[model samples]
Each structure stands twice: as C-alpha cells, then as structure tokens.
Target: MLTLTHRDMLTLKHRDMLAFGHRDMLAFGHMAMLTLTHRDMLTLTQRDMLAFGHMAMLTLRHLDMLTLTHRDMLAFGHMDMLTRTGTC
Candidate 1:
C-alpha cells in the first residue's frame, strides 16, 4: 500500500472536489474515507460527502426523465468516461 504523502493527499483532495463539482471559495478537506476500493482513496468534505450520497437519490428521481431526456444533454456529462481519452 502506498502511504499518502502531502502532495498525493493534495491531489486526491483536488480530485474529490472536482468530482463533486464543488467550485466554491471554500477550502475543502478530507474528513473521511468512504471506502477502500482497489486501494483508491475515496474521501470527501463534510458537506460534499452528504451531497455525494444524495446523488443516488436524486438520480432515481431524474431516471424517469430518461424517456423524455434529450440525447445531447445525456451524453455531455459522461462523454469522456464513455470514450477512451487516448490513455490506457
């Protein structure tokens, strides 16, 4: 297992913020590790951790929109993940 250096911790912190779209003036910190998945650290802010959880519930409500949803908008969110960005 790779022990987290200050730099690695900082990178992970940045990824967590970017993942949750929390682009505010607040300084976020890792309050907890959600889980240890394949050695990847999944940490979150106090507020964002709650928001991350609420996403599944929100997705359920929005799932119904799939039938009425426009194709362009749906593809926008996951266009990168759906396709390989020239990396392995």
Candidate 2:
C-alpha cells in the first residue's frame, strides 16, 4: 500500500516533486498532489486538506473509465470550476 507521511507532504511543495509510479493508485496520488500545493496549506489545516483531498479522489474516481484525454479535460475542468467557485 502507498503511505504518505507528513514529511512527504511537506517535501511535495511543487508538482515537479511528485513521483509518477506504475500503479493507478500512485498515479492518482500524483494528480491529488497537483490539486494540492504547499502554499495551499502552509498552515496545514486538516479541514482544508481533507476537503481538497476528498474532491481529488472523487473527481478521479468518476473519471477513471474515460479515455485519458477526456479524463484530463474533465479533471482540469473540475479545477477550473473549483477556482471559479473560490474553492481552490
């Protein structure tokens, strides 16, 4: 199983720091990290973190069956929606 520690979270300050893996779950972790950033939670609030994390999982889960292009579009579209909604 993949485990993410607090220190792991801290080191993943940028998307470039995310490591791509062979497993789907690990790839999802990369996407989640892209959604969440260090500046996003420098104060490290659990509530905010959970909210974003939940959204990332849900968004990816629903898009899992789609083609990569479609999935990418919708995933990024979700991000755009979140931004416009002031949720990001």
Candidate 3:
C-alpha cells in the first residue's frame, strides 16, 4: 500500500535491497537501476524456471518415482543375495 521513491531506494546497500523488491527494479528506466540489466531476458528466465520446476513436480507426482526406485533397489538386493548363494 506504500511505495519507495528512487531516492529512498538508491540509499539502500545491495544487501539491504531485498526488503524493497529490488530484484524487480531491473527496468527502472534509469540506467543505474539494472543489475544484470537484461530486463526482458531476466523476466523470461524466471518464468521459464518456475514453469520447468512445476512440470518436474507434476511428472514426479504422476510417476511416483521414489516408490519405483525403492522397488528397484529391493530387487537389486535380492538378486545380489541370490548371486552370492548361487541360487540363480
């Protein structure tokens, strides 16, 4: 519900910037406000990373990979035991 003017923001150190949404200042019109300074690219990269992370989570949820991996590990252990005893 409040805002910080450019002067107020400029007074903040890099470490202190986080409290003020400084990461979103990539397009502040003033040349000095840019960090990596590629505004569009930074925005796009953030969006893509979020999308990929969500997709990965959905895939993991659907595949139940942890249970499958545990089953495979148990199978491998049984095979190892059988091989040790020459049972198969």
Candidate that scores best on TM-score: 2
Per-model CA lDDT versus the true structure = 0.22, 0.28, 0.19
The stretch of ten residues in a row with the least summed lDDT in candidate 1 is: 51-60
- For model 3, what is the C-alpha lDDT against the true structure? 0.19
Poorest lDDT segment (10 consecutive residues) of candidate 3 = 46-55
> For each candidate, what TM-score against the reference?
0.17, 0.19, 0.14
Q: Which pairs in model 2 have colliding backbones? A: none
Instruction: List, in order, the clash count of every candidate structure.
Output: 0, 0, 0
lDDT of 3 by residue, 1-88 (tens): 1233343222322222222122222222111222221111222111111111111111112212211111111111211221111211
Model 2 Cα lDDT, one tens digit per residue, 12-81 = 3332223322322221322343333433322112112222232243222211222221112223233332
User: Which of the two candidates, 1 or 3, achieves a greater TM-score against the reference?
Assistant: 1
Q: Give stretches of model 2 more than 4 Å off.
A: 1-30, 35-41, 53-77, 81-88
C-alpha RMSD by candidate, in order: 15.8, 14.5, 22.3
Residue 33 in model 1: lDDT: 20
Which candidate wins on lDDT?
A: 2
User: Looking at candidate 3, what is the lDDT of residue 15?
Assistant: 29
lDDT of 1 by residue, 1-88 (tens): 1222222222322222223223212231223122222224332222322211111111212112111111111111111222112211
